[model samples]
Target: MELKTRMDGQVAVITGGAQGIGASTGRIMAELGATVVLADVNEDGANATAEAINADGGTAVGVRYDAFDKDAVRGLITDVAGRFGHLDILHNNVGGSWPDRDLQVLDIDDDTWLKIFDWNMHTTHWATTAVLPIMLEQGKGSIVNTITGGAQVGMSIQVAYGSAKGAVSSYTRYVAVQYGRRGIRCNAVNPGLILTPHAVEVMSEDFKRSLFDQITTVRAGVPDDIGYAVAFLASDAAGYINGEAITVAGGGPRSSHDAEALRVGAYGPSVPAPPADLILPDLH
Candidate 1:
């Protein structure tokens, strides 16, 4: 017998569903017969995603809104529930931080920090709060937040982003602990470097090739990797999995011991050093 996905008749609201993992997850959810609403500030990207899903005979809708606006977030939740009659899944894929000047903690201006905070953490809170009532009324729901590997081990440049994502990781557990009895499941997914259209713009081919060198899998993660994980956690198959932080990096970074082994010739394999280890999962 063939196994099937368990999202039939469900409705999912995915923020930043226009590109990358969010787009992939939205498509995956729709393929499983879920009504997906693609919400993003980028109207064009959202419409494109909706078009692809519709073309594939899946149900989808596109909505445009700035995630930082609490009112907009609340309205989105209300609209999705009203239109679909029920809401079952929520994917919080928004949040990004930069190390650029005026955004750093020491020298960064107040507005910049606040903006980053709002973008990375506040948006997630707003979206979650807005949907809580509906989820409570239904007595069952799943929420997945996107986090960063940098937050797990701490990277130098992405201070704000890491801090924001760290909060998400913690909040995932908090949500799960507080609401598990209420039948609401919350989890976080930390994605390694994924090759999205946006990423391709900033990364060179050689740079990407270098990133694959350090991982045990010798491959970088794609959007599908994260999407598939979210799908599993959102379904009844993962009914028992709540408050978990699933790292979606492929064969994450190697430990210093492995590096030393390779250095000391104990490991016969001569591995090519990747140009960038940032893209590798947190195997380290």
Candidate 2:
């Protein structure tokens, strides 16, 4: 009973809660007895997600929300707090870059590169700002931001997304320090390559194999892997943990570009060829 009620009476706002990591996070939180708002621009998906949770005897509501709109996000937060009597968590999970548009820094167009910030950092700032006053008034709250693992390490083909998320990570620490004594905590989770449904449908075997080459676990990350991580961080269980970035990736760095011939400075490092047993497969 205690396990199922870990988040009992808490209110959690999960942006992008219609699917993928967002949905999984909501489901787990609901199972723990928290009231979840599955806010997403995809109304149908959000409704479906909420219905599933409600059917399972959990408290949840779906709202058509666009995190990019400052007023809309503010209104959502206000409405949720007024209804729930208080807000306890904000899981900032709304952000993604178009794979087709995301390219090398020099190759990406101005509009495409800038849009990445709108989808990532801008939304995080807007959502966090909206929730601050509410949490402050309540005397406690947690913000779990979803940042990309490539933010600090850098993602070659996804430079724009990585850079924007890097800003989010920095902002997470800033918020943490700013609100620590005020009873609010802010942190970020850096997800490695989580293969959501869209990835499962679109990624080819070769593409997935290449992605797995860098991980020591040699297994693809799934959405549920991220769900549990966010739950713990958003709960009081992590009261002392603030201004940190938790990496949920299976471990290992993306070192393919380090082959020396791929690119200069960009490739990161060069290692002398290893012995037969120490040799790793050539990643494409």
Residue pairs in candidate 1 whose N, alpha carbon or C atoms collide under 3 angstroms: 210-275, 252-283, 253-283, 253-284
Error of 2 at 43 (Å): 0.5
Q: Report the lDDT tens digits of candidate 1 across residue range 1-284.
A: 53446688999999999888889999999988898999999989999999999999999998998988889988998999998899999998977765574334566667777787798788889989988889999999999999988777765465677788888899899999999999999998888777776676788876676555435665577788889888888888788999998988766544556645654457676665544554543320
Clashing residue pairs in all predictions, respectively, total: 4, 0
Using all chains and alpha carbons, the TM-scores for the candidates as numbered come to 0.89, 0.87
Highest lDDT, which number? 2
Residue 35 C-alpha lDDT in model 1: 89
Q: What local distance difference test score does each model get?
A: 0.82, 0.84
